[model samples]
Every structure is written in structure tokens, then in C-alpha cells.
Target: MSTDKKRFSADGPAPRQRFWKEAGVQETADGFTITLDGKPVRLPGGNPLCVTARPLAEALAAEWAAAGLDDPKGRFTPADLPLTRIAGTKIERVRPEREHIIATLADYGAHDLLCYRAETEGPLTVRQAEEWQPWLDWLNERHGITLRVTHGMMPIKQPEPALQRLRTLLATRNDADLAALGVAVPALGSLVLGLALADGAITPAQAVAAASVDERVQMERWGEDAAILDRIAAMNEDVTDAARFMELGRG
Candidate 1:
């Protein structure tokens, strides 16, 4: 995940003056780029913020265009450009450290959330099987890799062959996909759920629910906490944004 906390801050540096009148997309020899009143957009790394996918370019343009639409002062912040941020990370970070990123993300499979089950049998355990097992089964059936499930906090060592298979699969993804996975995997804390989200195998809501089964069960037993609810809401937004980023990049 990105360590640049400021970029994802909810109250990013006070909204700056909006200088551009409109946003547009222009096709270039390399790919497509977003333009602010005809001026090409540049990433923080000082390179043109170009995307090989036109759909992603157009989406970035739309985000720029809508930045201050709802604010009376016509000002905006980094939070207003989620797609652009992810795209920037794709170019500025993931590309250069592709192999390292692949390995880091694949490591999630070793201690994936779905692989850990509730210690005592009850609603949480039942819900775990109901919500999480299908995806584990999907992983085995689709990729021939079965992740061993354990009950409680004790970590179970996943099969080395399975981990290697996952790493190989992750190596096949492009930088853009890896960028999306970076967000979704950390947010969901489960490589299985993140891959499922990226692959269109599950919707963002489904991923969130499956990942939050423990929290949901706790909330049911002890009532909801406002803070936890807010966290879950933020998580859903993150996952949804990542999913959209992946979809646009594929186009």
C-alpha cells in the first residue's frame, strides 16, 4: 500500500484554488492523457500522467472536471481525485518495483483472513464457512491451490506450492492491476477477497461482507459501535474505488 498518507487524507491540505476551467482527454502515440484546459496533466513524479487505457484516461478526466463542482469556492484536494491517485501510484511506484510488489502481495495468501476461522463454533464460524469457504473453493477449483483453514489465532502454514502458484498468478498482472490490488488487498486484508474483487468474481459489497464476517458477528452479539461502522464504511469506499480503477484500466 502507499505510505503517502497525505494523498489519501480525508481532509487533505486545504483545497487549493481551482485553476482549470475544464478537463479533457487526448490520445497520444504512447497512450491517452488527461488534459486540464488542453494542458496535459502530469503526475507528481513530473512525468505525463498517461494511461494505456482510454477508459481510464477518460475517467481521470471526469474526476478532474468534477473536483470542485459541489463546492461553492471551486476548490479541491487530493481526496477528490481517487482514480488519479491510484493511476499515479501505478506509474510512480508499482512499475519500478513490480517484482517486489508481486512478492509482497502474494505473501498475503500465506495468512489470508479467510484461512483463519473463529475458535469456537457459533454464528461467526457458520458465517465464515457460508461467506468465505466459497472463495477458498473457487481458488482451489480455478487455480488448483487449496489454502488450509485453521480455527483460532494460531497461524497455519499454507502449502509452499500454493503460495508459489499465487505468486506466479500475481506476476501476470500489469502495474495498473497491481496498483488496484494493492489498495483492495490491504483494505480487505485477504488476498482471496482482493483477487476476487479484481477478477469481477465478487462485488465490492460482497467482498466487504465476507471480509467483515467477524466484525459483523461481534456487532450482532454486542451491538454496533459507531467507530467500527465508520471504519467499515470507509473500507467499502476504498474497495469500491479500487474495483472501479481496475475496471477502467482493463478498458
Candidate 2:
């Protein structure tokens, strides 16, 4: 991937100028659409921001409605509306540039978080192996890709064949699903966790928890602090939002 191709944002384009008296959802013959001041909402790409799932449409409408309350200036940021941000990216970025996204995701598998373990012999090592080994085994059985587990942070030379198989599996996802996977992959720092979520093998909450196993184990040993706990809570929300985004896209 080119350096420019690798530098993509999930937020996609900047937030549109808000100029609506009211925001709501409208059901159409095709599906559901969000409306601003009785007019249908349009994505940055100039296409109608419509979805087949009523829940997703409603969620998007609600995001717009909330923006009205929060910003009296009629200005909103992408950070304020997670669902709308994702929907916009699905249309503007992910759909148009999918191959690059696939390559970016496949790169994560080369040095997957699950394939690295602590060198020291202690509870943390045991915890990592116990939580990580099953998914490694699952990959081996399912795709004949056996990732080597290393005891240190040094780079591991993963087999090119295994990496190719992982990339092949990633290519099977549609744009919306791929967008969600892209978010989950970097957030969790585990390509396997991202794949598990995409494959419907694990819930978003499970993915978040699994990715933070080492941190949680350390928290357990040293007692939870307020700052770390708050950070974890925010991360959990982001991961769950990505998972929900994928589910809505499927609908």
C-alpha cells in the first residue's frame, strides 16, 4: 500500500454543516431514510444516506437530533455522532477504496498481538497463553495457518502462505463490514480479535475484553486506578459501537 493509501481515517470527511429545524426518520419503499427539516439527508458523496434497517436509520436520526440540542450554532463534529460518522465513511471512503483497506488489515496479521507472549514465567504468561492459544488453534484448523508464538517483542517472520490466507479471508467482507473490522483491528491491537468479530465468532464486548486481557491482569494485581478504569470504559464503548455498526450494515 502506498503511504497515502495507508493514511486513511475512519471519520472520513469532515462533518457537514447542520442547518435543520428538526431531524427524524422516514420509511421509504426501498428502506428507511433520515430526514433533516423534512428533507432527506445526503451523504458527503451526494447520495442519500439511507439504510434498510429501521434501527440503524433511527439511530442515525437520533444522532442528528442530539446534535441539534448540543450545538445551538447548528454545527456538529464527527466525534459527536459515531453512527453517522461510520455511515458516512462507508459511503465515501470504504466503498471506494476497499482494496487498500484489505491490505491494511492483512498487514496486522503479520505481527498479530495473539502471536506474542511474555518471556517471564508468571501468571501473566499463563493468562496470555490460555486466552490466546485457542484462537491460534482455530486459525490452524480452519485455514491451515499456524502462527508462531514468540516469547518477546522482537519481530517474528510469519509464513507468507499464512499471511496470504488471512488476507484472502479479509477480502470476503463487504465494505460496511470491512469498515467495522478496520476500526476494531487497530483499537484492539489484535487482528484475530477483529476477524473473530467479523466472522461473528465473538461479541464486541468479548473482543474488547480479550484484547485487554494483559492490562486487566495487571490491574487485578495492582488494583484498579480511576484513570485506567475510565480509559477502559471508553475503549469498551468504541469497540461495541464498531460491532453494532457492522450488525446494522448487515441488516
For candidate 1, list the clashing residue pairs, or say none. none
Q: After superposition, how far is residue 144 of candidate 1 from its true place, in Å?
A: 1.0
TM-score of candidate 2 relative to the true fold: 0.83
TM-score of model 1 (CA atoms): 0.92
For residue 229, give model 1's deviation from the true position in Å. Answer: 1.3
- For all predictions, the C-alpha RMSD in Å is 4.0, 6.7
Model 2 over residues 101-157: C-alpha lDDT tens digits?
Answer: 888988889989999898889998998988888888877876678788899899999
Candidate 2 regions off by >4 Å? 1-19, 26-32, 44-47, 68-76
Residue-level lDDT tens digits of model 1 in 183-230: 899999999999888789999999999888888888999999988897
Steric collisions counted per model: 0, 0
